[model samples]
Target: MRAQSSATGRTAKAVTPPHAPSSARPAGRGAGTGAGTALALSGVFCFSLTFPSTVWGLESFGPWSLVALRGVLAAAVAGAFLLMWRVPLPDRRHWAGLAVVGGGVVIGFPLLTTLALGTSSTAHAAVVVGLLPLTTALFAALRTGRRPSRPFWAAAVAGAAVVAAFTWQQSGGALSVGDLYLFGALLVCAAGYTEGGRLASRMPGWQVVGWALVLCLPVTVAGSAVALALEPVHWSAHGAVGLAWVAAGSTFLGLYVWYRGMAGIGVARASQLQLAQPLMTLAWSYGLLGEELTWAAPLAAAGVLICIAVTQRACD
Candidate 1:
């Protein structure tokens, strides 16, 4: 990611006259920073409710049906938006990346987590998913083919350590099979997020996700139909709403800003900010599910926040 962009920026500079004012320089720099910060936080906020939504949705739908239905519903919304805005379809060169994005984000993560949640408590799942930032950073490094510096690595590891320690404490120092599923989800989701971020650098963030959702339609639609045919769904109003939230908010719109932030900032830095997600998830659980708020919750948030701050500087 860094290599291609740096090369392109250099190539453009080489073509310009020495005395040119370079009007493009100042625009993306300052604005990009602010946009990245806002977008990253916004995306995390949208994602924080996924656990609750899944819990509610599973009351009516099986894990496979939930994922399939969510994908189809999200695809419809994304398709309408892309057509309304007249966003161009991705060219052949981008098809592979788009496929990767669809597979990981649209299919893999949701299916894996939903299945995991079937066997685990939401609280346990939330704590486990706090590892996402580290997974994302790892994938970002791989995608960019740029190794993080020693300080950057330290910050990243520290952030992950904080999450692991908190989760182990919360879950009684043991990890379940569900936790393994969530870990797998993190790996695939990281690849999706990193790839989508790279795509966002070249086009609008919404367009990238929109196109991905559309591309997912054939599989999503077919799978949903087959599942519904095989296993009857006992849908409820509350469950429908929960499914809608996951489909519209988590699958589609959340990605809009997530990729934007990753493009504006580097993927590593933006991913570090995801350290705050489990806390936000905890808050949602407390308010919505009547879950008890642990006294250490705030302390955990503070420690993770500090780690994220250190990571920001270290990465910079």
Candidate 2:
């Protein structure tokens, strides 16, 4: 859980005990919650294109370069907004959480998933990341003491199991290095989302994301430099467009709305909205990357959607 204290400095615990009882719950199924769900869905839509975009980017840039350059570009946009709005610095108590968000979301997820994408098809990667909602909920419950009801957990597990089974069937029931990377991405990204959601409650979602991007500027700038120097580059129309989308749409705008959604709805409830992301990604992969649309996808989508509906009701 976040340190709930006054503006005056005071020692406070940053995380909840593992067995901590659920102290947080969704307020109700109100207009604000509905709006939050909508915002979260929009973010999911943006993110659904990420794997295809990264595939396009890899045509010109190496995995390291694409990941680092996107971070630099995203930070530049975020910085411009922060300057225009004259957003003040976050409290010191929040910086640790911001650091976690920067490391996991900005750096870790992008790099790991990009590497995984070099070997794995976008459809495969999307199905694997379908597990993210459950991972995020687990992190949120641990970090924020927000425990969802048993029905919510059941629905979450069902959604995740559907995705996992789909992934397993697709991968021939074997683990690859790409699968390992995706799993790692899940852990770090989940932690980042949980922390970002916690921080969003104290400030505007855009500010939370903007500041985290700014916080990682130095590392990203240097990484961009090193990656460009070492990796060969070939400029292309698709590469440029892909880079632009991942930077502006996925990294900046998507996260801004996502954190906002998590702030409006509780983190656990908001996360379940991502159950649709893999299906959306599958559609994108088929259309954009010309990946084969597996027959199992439709079934997985049905199961995931039902789970999402159940989780939303259970949360309420």
Candidate 3:
């Protein structure tokens, strides 16, 4: 997930120019920090609901249907927004990066995670995905040529260790097929997040995701048609709502804010905020799916939150 701007294709205005007067610097910095943090947190909240929503969707839609339909549906919404604002196509030079974003975020992650949810409980899948923040930070560092502080790495590592330990304990120390799918999702999604954050610095965060979704429209449309034909639909209220949330809330809106936040705050710090996401998903799973909440949840959540605080303070 990803940054902010107007519907008319403006980039984020939160950044303070290096040429700005010293007297104006502090206020500009403060505003940018506050807005960036809020946007990142909003994205986290939207994503936290995804696993539970996917589980609910699986009740009526097959994994393939759920994944393809979510993409198609999200694309339609993004396409409409782009047209409404007359957003121009991205530059040719940016297409390769956009392809990575489209392939990974729009295609790879959703498909793999949906498949994983078939066998794994939302809580288990969520904790596994908790590895995403660190993965994304590593990707951002390599791709964007920005290095975070050693303290930040220490906190990020500690958080990942907590999540890994929790997943291992929950899964009885054996990797399931679902775990394999989730790990795959983690790697691809991290690449997408890092690239999306880079692109957001040049364009509106919403447009980066908007264009990526639009770029995948052809494949998603075809996939949706074929998947709907093959998958048996058993539609219900939960299924309908679940599909709607994943498509609208998680895919488009979540990514828009997330990319913008990354542009505002830097990808590494924005990603650390996601340490809260798995815990939020755990709560959603318990409440929405009535899945058993384990005793390990509180311990893991506390550890992750402390890590988040440390990383946030550790500086870029």
Candidate 4:
């Protein structure tokens, strides 16, 4: 659900140097920050809509079926963009990396998240996903051999504690197993983001994302076919609309903007903006799904935002 670059073609920020650390200040740092922040906030809003849409669509569709349709639709849209742009096909060396990232981001995250939301509330899913920045930071540190500042670690720990406390309170002493699955999905998403950021530094961000989707098209199509074969099809107007929104807004445009931002801002700091997602999602749940806004919502939102700010400031 990231910001779609306007059709009028804004200038892209130059990719960061490979030798630069993931947390290094970006070129055109101010502009990059503004653009990335805007895109990330937009993504949060767009992504917030996805859970409700998933819930709506799932009323008539199986979770895997919904996931499969999302992949196929998103891949088709992205493939069209590639063709329109005349983007060259990725080289053989990139195929494996693209497959892994596509599988994680396009297939794994959506499926697990939809499944998790089947049992958990959208608010619960949002709160769990707020931890993505922390997960991404941890992975970046491990991958780059760059130790995070003490403040970063402290913020991450504090954020996790807040999330745990909030989840426990919300669940009435029993932790929802679905929350665990969301956490796993976030971890996989973090890995994909980290690797994709590295790749974006070397290639055009659009190219990286575009080629990955192209490589993923066959797998996504086959998966969709299998799901269709297994499940009874009962497509409704509401379901069709939801699927289109998820495909266009969440998957295609979202990844495009996210990758573009990652190319300029690098993974760690860029990932911090993801903390806003849960807050945005909470707002969406209240407005769109008529979910009640409880005390925990504000507390969790503030805690995560503070953690993200602290960590990002420390990195800067």
lDDT of 2 by residue, 122-239 (tens): 9888888889999999999999887889999999999999988987887799888999999999999999999999888776788788889999999999999999999999999999
Clashes of each: 1, 2, 7, 2
- Candidate 4 wrongly placed segments (more than 4 Å): 1-31
Q: What C-alpha lDDT values do all the predictions have?
A: 0.78, 0.85, 0.86, 0.74
Question: Cα miss at 74, model 1 (Å)?
Answer: 0.8
| Pairs in clash, predicted candidate 4 | 1-43, 2-43
lDDT of 4 at 50: 79
Error of 4 at 151 (Å): 1.8
Question: Model 1 over residues 38-115: C-alpha lDDT tens digits?
Answer: 888899999989888988888788888899999999999988866654444555567788888999999999999999
TM-score between candidate 1 and the true structure: 0.86
Q: TM-score for model 2?
A: 0.90
Worst 10 residues of 1 by lDDT: 1-10
lDDT digits (tens) for residues 1-316 of candidate 3:
1123334455434443355322212211334788888988999999999999988898889999898989999999988877765555665678899999999999999999999998988888888888999999999999989899899999999999998898888889988999999999999999999999888877778878989999898998899899989999998999999999999999999998888888789899999999999889988998889999778875777778789889999974
lDDT, candidate 4, 1-316, per-residue tens: 0112334344433334456323223222444667766655565666767787887778667888888888888878777766654444554566677776787788778888988988998988888787788888888788767677788788887887787788888888987789878988988888878777767665556566666777677877888889878978687877777787877778777776676676666677777777777888788788878887788977897888778788778777
For candidate 3, list the clashing residue pairs, or say none: 2-258, 2-259, 2-260, 3-259, 3-260, 3-261, 4-260
> Could you tell me the lDDT of residue 165 within candidate 3?
91
| 2 against 4, candidate with superior lDDT | 2
Give Cα distance to truth, residue 56, candidate 2, Å.
0.9
